[model samples]
Target: MCSPEMSRSSDVDVRRTETRHEATHVKARRPGKGGACGHMALCHWALVAAMLCGPARTQRPPGIPGRTAENDVPLQTAAWLAEGRITAIHLPKERPRRLYFTLPKKTSAFSVTVVPCDVPVEWSLMVRTAEDEPPKQQRTYKKSMPEVWWGNSRKNIKVYSNVGNAVDTYRGPAYAPASIYVVKLQSREHSTKVSVYLQEGAGLPKVFPELPPDPQVRVVGVGMSSVTLRWPSSPSVPKVHQSNTSLQYCVLVNLKHNYRGLCAALEALRRDKKIEEVKRQGATLWPTPKAWKQQLGPHRKDVVFPAPVPDGPPELPCVCQGVENTCTVSELQPDTLYYLDVFLLDSSSGSSAAYTGTSARTHQEARPTGTALRDSKPRWVALAPHGGRLLSFRPRGWPPRALLTMQVCSPHQVRVTASGQTQVLAAEIVAEEPVQIWLQGSPSYLIYLENESPATVAEEAIVKIQASSAYHRQAPVLPPLRTVKSYSKLKTCNSVTVGWHGTEERNLYCVYHQQLDSQGGPTGLEQCLGPESRSDTERAVCKYFQDLNPQEAVSTATIGGLEPGTAYLFDVYMVRRFGIAIKYHSKIVRTKKDC
Candidate 1:
């Protein structure tokens, strides 16, 4: 007689096969073959029949092969299998098996793949939730047999079969975090074996480990629309412990409406004397913990809880990662107080560390209405060759000190004098350009510009002057160069053509080239060429052009002395007034292998 476990396994197979045969009215039979069980005696068949006809069988249709009640045999339960275990089960003819397990609270999904042994077998799989509702059924093989082949030419040679395999995935409604799930496996005819592989959770930890100690965090800057935060680098840990680990950050913003509501609710909860009654009424209004740090156990000390925002709403933070030690949050309300909490996440182990909270208030928007610096447009001044133009005006409601700005609108050798002073405040004798001068002690001033060029007096030129409060002083603005192009039209093995437009003044233009590695990082063969050179190699590689006309906007330079069959990156920039460098464009070029 078969043992209780063996009997139950056979019974499960009988019920499943009977159900399938009843629906299709077809029976699957295995031919007598020479293999593992080919030499079994008649007693073996008798034992299988007895197991199928035992009390476990329930009344069913006359033509069906197995008892219906056999499907109810209690399943073996086990804890979640660890990451690398290959669980297997042996199923005899007509028997089915069931397994129950629980998923971790952080587990989002689970998957299982069933690989059958070398035999002809039909299998059916069903997954049900805790509620016992069978939402779907997955079948691996239907009316099919494993592929068979003979290993040798001799008839006595061994035969091989390719067992069927199928993968079933459970997600969302089929399985939930921290919920119970059931998986049932049943085989139709022939006694066979199967190996089950399961992957639980979405490959992430449900709970993170504690953070290391003494983390420092601070607010670096605040503005009307944004706040900048900074923190020290995470402490270094052993590679074995931190491999595959990454960090992510989150920031929560409490809207104005929610903030006010939470503050009022907390105050009311504090004043209520009957704690039980308040609790019974659902004290959901209580604030959440100040930060995730409070959730860590007492053993961790490096992290500190952020103080709750005073009279402000509970925090709803926002998060970002990848900005080493510094992160900026924008799109904030003007003149508002904000509480920020920053945290660190270890992705591999699902561990997190948080910094102490910091708070800052944004400044009110600046209003420049009614100020002398507002709406001041550039005024045009004409100068004849070797002649000068003078203008005097008092700026009303001006600051004690103001910024006087002047730009030559046309090509001219211009000299500027202020307040009748003999000293020349600014001159652009070499090239027409913009100039800024600081004026103090008086709001009224005389300004004069003369065409000091040796050209004849018949030639005419134009200049524009703009004066404003020093608070309005802004960096010089220049139009960006566009349509940057790089090519090797000459097909030279060691040269490339770099061209661009939009040069507004006699500013110094430079082309920098560097050999780059496969990852685009510099390989230390960096070289720069321009109108000015600070090194011997730069002087040898660069060509100088003097007194370039602004109207001659288009410029191109040919760079040589490059190695054959090499990749190089090039960028161009201009040094504007006051020595401000502005990058215009960049490109990559690869040289031909041979000339």
Candidate 2:
């Protein structure tokens, strides 16, 4: 990155270097139609004399008193313009023959132009009129087919390079006013070689300034039935001279004080037009005062109020749901007196107004009660195992097994007795929240039912199981298979770890071992191998489980100490806490003898 100081110096150097050179080509003119000036038109003697003289031959140029040849001093190069040197002299079509010139390259960088008549532009400064002018600067860039360079406005101006060879025609004024402007060719590698050209009378005609923008207006707020309007903040401008450069604004408002009155008026207009589209939708919209109030929000003071809620419902239930912004009113007799309030909201004006109207009505029949629970499906009561405590009963009717309605309705310990049988189930009721009671069987079948009424005596509304042994059937369950992995063999002995996984929620594991005869039948399997081989070891058995390698799989037990080349029978069983156990026997594996 270039340092700020270096950058500034480079900028100044490009515009102010004192190298001056003579114009390379002699001046010549090419005339077209009448009053048409060509690229080198100033070179014509007649035009040159016309530019230097006053039309009436009476008024002199602003600075000259006596016409002297000294005023025609040799013109300076664009770079030497800052030392108070004239680059070119411009002539007015109608005259006092005004003259205009600008510092050369300095003018090229901006939208600067020198008009022969010297009145300053409005809303912008006139450089000549200001005494504190800063030193001018220029920046140079390498030329390309489509040359993109920054102008004085800091906006890029595209100059087409392919148009002319060695000679570039500038379609637009290169900023400054002058009959001649000059630029030098710096060598390809920054070598200070120089060249010059006189480019006076080479620009197109100038254009005028554009028109101003439209004003901003808005509807800032809207209520249930009203609206507010506003406009953006604008700066005040004072009337000035004869320049077409000023702006102005205006405001207006319309209001419909009462909502009913507005709605009625709208309805009346709609009827006169016979417009079906003007009819209200299926539901009548009678917005409540509260709804209108809420719609106005904090800006309520600036809006029109809406009509109040109508008085009536099927039964005018103590509690009811109302329309979004509206409130509900109850307890008025048929044909009672009521008033409606409407508001007008003008957010733009920051103002509001309310209007009121009266109305009367008659009542209608009451509505039906809403549904709470459906009755098509059988309600789930409870599911439990046999021999476990029966928690509670529901509906308190005959058969008494269907409905699961009662959740923590009574203590879990509650019991009912009937027909010489005492109900043994109890429930635990938790306070504040819903609780559940699971039922279990006691060796018999039972049916569930409900009754509309219950008997006062224990004999009435009685709940009883139809069968005494309805709860004893064993639930269908599967036994687990025994598994052994990571087997190892040593001299005369084989070892393996045993374990199992089961789906039965009540299953437990038990390991067993035995020897097989030649016929593959167990032989003397019950013989004691000491407590080390004991499966029922709660009484006494091995002290510690065998050590396993890090790479070994995890299992329940490690079995060792087998006869070399002998087949063995190993089995594991799944046992339930209160039921029978099933064994899952494993295939025999012979031991290897190498020791």
Candidate 3:
């Protein structure tokens, strides 16, 4: 039951047919016929014939063509993709279906959403529109669209492609007078069914007509699970567009299509029995990041981004609302492409003015919560009472060497360690003086800044690193990190106050305390909570003072109702939307005993 328009689903795990295996029977198109294969989960394409025997629903096994002029079902009524039959084994396969529909005349914008009923399948969509044949810098809005027949010549043809239904932009009044849209759906083994939605609305809305161009944005840096973005704080509004209402930038993050299939594929690979033994030992799926890289070689440039599953906490998802131009969206899926939209909104009128859209891919591995530097530049880092800063930079050439110049105030010392290196470097600075050091090259260097100033005082230092040749150096903004530092400041016969540093950017945290046994190990479940309130069950237990408590200081909490002269351990954990980081702090302290 294969049709002529199936592309590889990057999971090209070529194998002999197994029991009810999926994607085994996809129909691939002929090599010389269709368009270039996109680097995505492509499993469907349209096999359009130039003739129409009847109305729009009369779709027969038509020959291969791109867009035809007759009998397209006018995209009128709204349809819902719900109530699908579960795919069963031994069922006859369904051919990939292409539903052609023409947008109504005077159409401004619309969006397409295709969701699979069961197992995920990549669907294809194309809209034949017009794009400028001229260079982008010179291209400007003409009074009207060029007078040309659709699909008649190469200059007249510009196909907007939507690889999978993670929602294409609420874009386009369209390039030409009549933009014909077509959606290709695949019926693979598991249900081979997907619900397609065709409606008119803005997803990542195109710029409004006559509105001034939206303010521009720049990418500061991209880490594994976070993205740092900077845009203009006060984007100018035209006199006509400006009103009494204040304008602010609205930033929305949407998931991209590139990493969706790869996220799915790498998850399946993790279930292999061979990797099972190694899984229990650590954070990595394989023995090392290098070994994990080797396993994903079959996927080529894909499969590195492993999106946290069940589901990611929404992308429109996360509304990155800001009055200032800079913000970092954290807790994002690693190795995934994130579509970002920054627009100016008139808060009083509740209407949007100008906007810009862009996309960036996150790093494969989640980096620590610190100012991350990819370029060799100067950075000023503020030390939060024993906090650390990581200086990440590139080298000028092979056989590497890079120069670092650091300035620290009097009574402060800086401890520097190169991440992923054999040798470490450290230096101390005299008050009001600058120090210079040469660092061995690596992707990043971890440097901890410490000051002899009072604990309540925070210090800022100027650091400049020269890796590659550069004309001008820019400063870095270091985000905070959760160190293993903890303190038990106040204690009584029955209570004690404990605290640990929590990440200010990601504030969700949990602190747990349990009484330790004579050997300093966690005692039985019952004795852990209380000597009097013992547990009847034999399992060991750990109790948290605050579980995912957002409002509390989260960094510190007081525990009461404890046994006298008892030894207890306190631990701090940073809670994330998908999962929690490693135990940041675990220390044992003694409760004071009454005379």
Best by lDDT: 1
Query: What's the CA error at residue 60 for candidate 1, in Å?
Result: 24
lDDT of 1 by residue, 1-595 (tens): 3344434344346666667646532211332464335435334665677577654433221112233232222222132234334555667677755443444556656554444544433443333223222222311212111000100001221111222432223323223312234345566656655545556645422233233465555778889888887766655433344323354454433322121112122223444667666434322221233243332335223221133422223333333332245777776666777665555544443234455556777776653222222224445567788888766544545454445566554555677766522233443342244466666566455566678766643657676566554433443445444345875576468887777664445556667677666536322111112223333344223332333454566667888898888887776656544422434444777888977
Provide the clashing-pair count of each candidate structure: 20, 34, 7
- Candidate 3 stretches greater than 4 Å from native: 1-97, 102-215, 219-228, 232-319, 322-325, 328-595
Residues 356-384 of candidate 3 have per-residue lDDT tens digits of 45678887764454455554444555555
Question: Which scores greater on lDDT, model 1 or model 2?
Answer: 1
lDDT of 2 by residue, 1-595 (tens): 2222222233234333222111212223344454346444544654565565433233322121122222111222112322222122322222212222344444443232221112211111122222222223321233211111112212222222221112122234453322222221112221111111223333321121111142222334333332333333222222232122122121111122223222232233323342333222111222322333353345433222123333332132211122111223333333323332322322222222222322223232232222112221212222121112232222222333222222111112222211111233433322212222333432221222232222321322222121111133333244222353324532245654545444524344555666667536432222212223444632211222222332232235566666666666666554433222333434465566544
Our model 3 lands, by Cα RMSD against the true structure, at: 28.8
Off by over 4 Å in 1: 1-17, 20-69, 72-206, 209-341, 353-460, 464-595
Compute the lDDT of residue 36 as modeled in candidate 2. 48
Q: Give the TM-score of candidate 3.
A: 0.22
Rank by TM-score, descending?
Answer: 3, 1, 2
